[model samples]
Target: MNLNIFIITSYSFFDQDLEKLFLCNLKYQDFSKNFKNYENYSKLSSNYKLDKSKHWITNVTHLFKFSREFKNFIKRYTNYYLLNCLIFVSIEFLPEKIASVVLGFISFQTFVDKFGTVFSIILVTILQMSNYHYTVLILTTFYGSWNLSEDLLIPYFNKIHFTMSEQNQWLNTRKGVLFGIGLVYYIMMQKFPLISFIIYSNAFFNMGFLITKITNEIPDNSKSLGTWSITESVWDGHDKFLGESLTS
Candidate 1:
């Protein structure tokens, strides 16, 4: 598998982007332990120069040919994410299970679109009256946070050279996003909260979305679908969470 990965990665420059990305972000998951010495972390921060290094290689900025155009794309993309999240989170608590109806209507539209709004309100209605989890609901606010963070945090994590502990924290954050959904659901006995967090908090601006697209390889090998732009939908098997609840 390693050789195959190398062969696939080395053959095409696009593959190199993937290898570099995985190595840059996924590979050194544990070096943070050594950095726990504080001195090491300080050295890293100094050497890396946090603020100055915001635009790491292959991020959204460099990837999109037109910054203005990309911003528009991000606005649409973020809206889509926030909208679906609004729906999925809503359905989690609904006793009657509008998942079928919600998903059916949503299936026809991308959340980033205007149509997303129509379905979102409808789903929110279904869940508002059903069994829900407040803890999960509160934490799920992070859905928007995660979405927002993805445009910034995930890539930033990728850019910074991390220590093992730092990497662990990173992994935790990523996993927590998924695990919390399920854990909270089980604990809360299903009664959840209002569906405004994701929508009201971030108003689908192009800035963050565009920021997510800092990378520039035509075929992005870094992560899902060649998009250095953040806010991707992934399947962690362990994290079907609201996705499963809503889709089921």
Candidate 2:
């Protein structure tokens, strides 16, 4: 495999967008003992300016940032992490082709997407890390299918729902809209064999459905807060415990 291909595939498909974030947001203070090889890199000065004094500082920064982000992602999104882990473990037990198909479909989800590249890299790193192998093919296929579903199909479905609900009384319910959307995919798969891969996978559709299920589980008042955008200041109730604010 070419160096460029390995780097692109590993960084883009495998790491998701984490590698990009790590490279872009690296601060000068990142060269501490948290990173394996850079224990002494930043110890000399607390106020050192970033420059090319050391060529390998960026590489060390990548490792430190990756470690921190990976831990934080797993901690804050524990359920999402566990689901991806389960999917990864399933790859070992299932047939190679079947596992690849499932992995590709699951990669469409936001949380699983981040670890997809990492998982792909780990699979091939020991024996043929540089080779552009089946892992790459499977992940890229899944990622592409996911993109098509999200960018094209879901928006189309939403439009159809809105149009039909406005024109027809019978097609106004949520169930009616869902059924109509599923019917569209079913018809497409039946009529056009070429696009069957995307129609059958339905990765984005499943994600939307799962999220809707979770959203319905939340209590009424809490759901409103969940969707609201917060700007700068945070609210903390005082209840005269520490004296009321003068403005209040």
lDDT of each: 0.35, 0.34
Error of 2 at 122 (Å): 2.8
Error of 1 at 112 (Å): 22
Q: Cα RMSDs of all predictions?
A: 17.1, 21.6
lDDT of 2 by residue, 1-248 (tens): 11221222223222224322322222222332132112221122221122346555564454345433223222433443455455657566887666655554544443233457667455434313332245444443333333222222222222122222231231222222334344555445546756554544453334333222211222224233223212101222223322432434
lDDT tens readout by residue for model 1, 26-80: 2233243222212221222211122224454444444343233234335534564
Model 1, poorest ten-residue lDDT window?
Answer: 1-10
> In model 1, how large is the Cα lDDT of residue 13?
23
TM-score of 1: 0.24
For model 2, which pairs clash?
Answer: 14-117
CA displacement after TM-score superposition, residue 63 of candidate 2 (Å): 41
Clashes of 2: 1
